[model samples]
Target: MFPSKSDFLLRLTTCLLSWVSALILVLIVWFLFVESELVWREVGVLRFLTDDRWSPSGDFSSAQFGLFPMIVASLLLAVGSILLAAPIGVGAALFAAYYAPRGVRQIFPRIVELLGGIPSVVYGLWGLVVLVPLISAYHPPGTSLLAGIVVVAIMILPTVALLTLSTFQQLPTSLIHSAAALGIAPTGIVRSVILPASRSGIMTAVLLAVTRAVGETMAVLMVCGNVIQAPSSPFSPVRTLTANIALEMAYAMQSHRSALFATGLALMLVVTLLVLIAEQQRGKAGHV
Candidate 1:
């Protein structure tokens, strides 16, 4: 049978959009590579990645561009945000999917979606004004790793919750009904049936949230104190790879600029890996 006009138009439009997106991504990676090649030649990949100093300017003797601290800070911030956001987001998703009244089910999701729509800069400002002051009451400097983590967690919470809720909503009603008929308690049905069935989707949601946390710049830059030191504790100030690039890219020149491009390349690589992993999990979820 021939495809209808609407169907053909829809397929053509989607295919064109997909190719455009792929082309744009390729251009970005190519730009990063061309710009960063100079630094790669001078610094060597191992030292550029593993060294703990990031002084891009000094006498040729003492200048160092170690990224270990920023790398560590980025990992800590992303992981910490995931740790804090996952359980809360998942629980809220479960409540929305399985327990909420119809009105609440409608309103709550919109509220969460609105949270996601809020600008990153606004979140940064809020963190700096409200969260930083609150933390400063207990800790000396308000801006620290803890503040960054909290801000990121809040920023990603809506993403996780909405995605997880969609995952739960996708479960077959018949399967849930069968479990109910078999005398499983509601909680038991959730634990043994719903959770296991939606595991891949939940993992995808969590990974996507982690990706957002890893790539977040403005909020983290504002709250993380921009200190290029490995964090000793959650209260310690530290700079992340994204924050480092954003902070330095404006004034950087020559090798300094190239190094910042290298930092962006690193960030791109990390986010790309995460997106690929999430896509894999999403594919598995679709199959299940």
Candidate 2:
């Protein structure tokens, strides 16, 4: 049978859009790599990856561009946020998917979606004003790794919840019916069947949330104290690569600018790895 004209147009349009998006991503990666080559040559890969110092001013001979601290901070921020948010988000998703009244379900997901839509800067301001002060009362200097973790956890909550909720809701009706026929309780079904079936989706959701946490800038910057040291504890101040780039790009010059670009490239690689993991999980979920 011949395809309809509208169907043909729709496929062509979608294909073109996908290609365009891929082209844009390629261009961005290419630009970052090209611009950062100087720093790679100047600093060498081993020192760039392993050195803890980040001083980039004064003579080039004295300057350092090691990103180890920022790398550690970024990892802590993402991992901590995921640890804090994933359980809460997953619990909320379960309630929304199976326990909430219809009206409550509708309203709750909408509220979550709204949270996702809110600007990052607004979240930053709120963290700075409310969360920081509250933490500072108990912790002294509230703008620390813990603060960034909390802020980024909140920032990624909606995403994790919504994705997890969707995954739960998409479970096969037949599986639930079979479990019910076998006299499985609701809690037992969720524990043994639904959750196991949706494991890949849950992993994808968490990975995606981690990616967002790692890439977040303004909110983390506002709460993370912007210090260059490697964090030894959750209460210690630290800086992430994203925060580092945003903090100094405006005044950076020469090799300093290239070093920033190199930081950006490193960040891109991390995010790309996370996205690839998420895609792999999604592929597994589809097969299941």
Candidate 3:
């Protein structure tokens, strides 16, 4: 009877907690909509989206608020960093899961897990102190879209590596053994058997990593130079939507404050889309 009561309580607790989480998500969406409504009403969604600059001089009447540059920067930063990190992260995962020696297999993944544990601010600080200077040596000012991409790639690398490693580890050992028994080289076995088996899993890792890279703020803000312009080159100074909101939200008033909320709303939608994509990949992986 006591065990039955305890089980009921546990089940009830989990159900309540699940509802609470759902409530929080609904609340967040409600809050963003409520706060952003003013901007949508005032700016008209199309004009707000298509305007080409973000400059605030004396007041709201004289100021121009454009999100295009920030939007472009954020996309470039997210895509470029994912492109740079995906291959390296996948390679590391393959090495750790399949090719590493007995001793290295234990140590390598622990190092990667530890890297993921480090705080974003610490990465930002390191970039500010170390990486920015290194880039500056090549050019007059070091902070640019390139710096943000490098920092974000490094930040998301562990995420990609860890997930891919888990995916690789889950592959059926019997299949690998059969391929090897057929006189296939290690490289050929990986390319033909393991990679095809793990395609959906690898994509899930990449989409999840891109989600993180898109939402990253502190490190990007510190190193991205915060210039509101479309990035013409990797070296061009740029500002992301996250960086823009972080830089201005504090002192902003009225329309400006609502604009920040609108930016947050945009970010939320983008993240939600990425999350949906990742979940679809995860479902495919499960079926595979």
Q: If scored against the real structure, what TM-score would every candidate get?
A: 0.92, 0.91, 0.93
Give lDDT tens digits, candidate 2, residues 1-288.
Answer: 427998888888999999998899999999999998887887777877776588876656788768888888999899999999999999999999889999998899999999999999988899889988898899878899998999899999998999999998888888889999999999998899888899999999999999999899999989889988888888888999999999999999888888899889888998999999999998885323
Q: Evaluate model 3: give its TM-score.
A: 0.93
Better of 1 and 2 by lDDT: 1
Query: lDDT by residue for model 1 over 1-288, one digit each (tens)?
Result: 436998888888999999998899899999999998888887778876666678876443466888888888999999999999999999999989889998899888999999999999999999999999999899869899999999999999999999999998888899899999999999999999998899999999999999999999999999989988989989998999999888988898877888889889888998899899999999885432
CA displacement after TM-score superposition, residue 47 of candidate 3 (Å): 1.6
Better of 2 and 3 by TM-score: 3
Q: List the candidate 2 regions with Cα displacement exceeding 4 Å.
A: 1-18, 286-288
The candidate maximizing TM-score is: 3
What C-alpha lDDT, on a 0 to 100 scale, does residue 70 get in candidate 1?
87
Clash tally for model 1: 1
- Each model's backbone clash number: 1, 0, 0
**Residue 47 lDDT (model 2):** 76
Off by over 4 Å in 3: 1-14, 56-62, 286-288
